[model samples]
Target: MRCAHCHEDNDLGLKPPPPKLQGVMRKGKMPSRAVATDQSVAQTVLAGKGKMPSFAGRFTEEQMRALIAYLRTDMPLPQQ
Candidate 1:
């Protein structure tokens, strides 16, 4: 599989790390942490958030869906 952001060839079996935490917190409020779930990753790729570039025009929705499905099967989540 290729990196959605860089287009560099990445092993489909390799699991990507979660996105870094962002946003400010009020007093006694917990920090906002965003995970790298399959859905989030697809949205990020489609919307191009942060360091991720959008794949909206580059790939068709069906292609994106296939990629997501492949990733889900090839890259299992790490043990907590």
Candidate 2:
């Protein structure tokens, strides 16, 4: 998990870990308290928000789709 909120330890005295993202898609809350759609989440991942960095131009369309799918379910990651 590249997302620091989900994988990294806060041993360096950073803010506590972010909320778990297990049902963020179904609950419509992610990156913040605001509601978000799939398109919105993709946009956020691409454009970034707050401390999160943008991933624009970093992934192919298929990779982006696969990442989103993984976030929404337990699907395996698409091969590069």
Q: Estimate each model's TM-score.
A: 0.46, 0.67
Which residue runs of candidate 1 sit more than 4 Å off their true CA positions? 4-38, 75-80
Instruction: Write the residue-wise lDDT of candidate 1 on 1-80 in tens digits.
Output: 33532333332333464332221111212122445565665666687765455667877778878766655454432222
- In candidate 2, the residue pairs with backbone N, CA or C atoms under 3 Å apart (3 or more residues apart, or in different chains) clash, namely none
> Residue-wise lDDT of candidate 2 within 13-65, one digit each (tens)?
44555444566776677858777677887888799877667889987889778
Global lDDT of each candidate? 0.47, 0.64
Root mean square deviation (Cα) for candidate 2: 4.5
What's each prediction's clash count?
Answer: 0, 0
Candidate 1 backbone collisions, by pair? none
RMSD of each: 9.9, 4.5
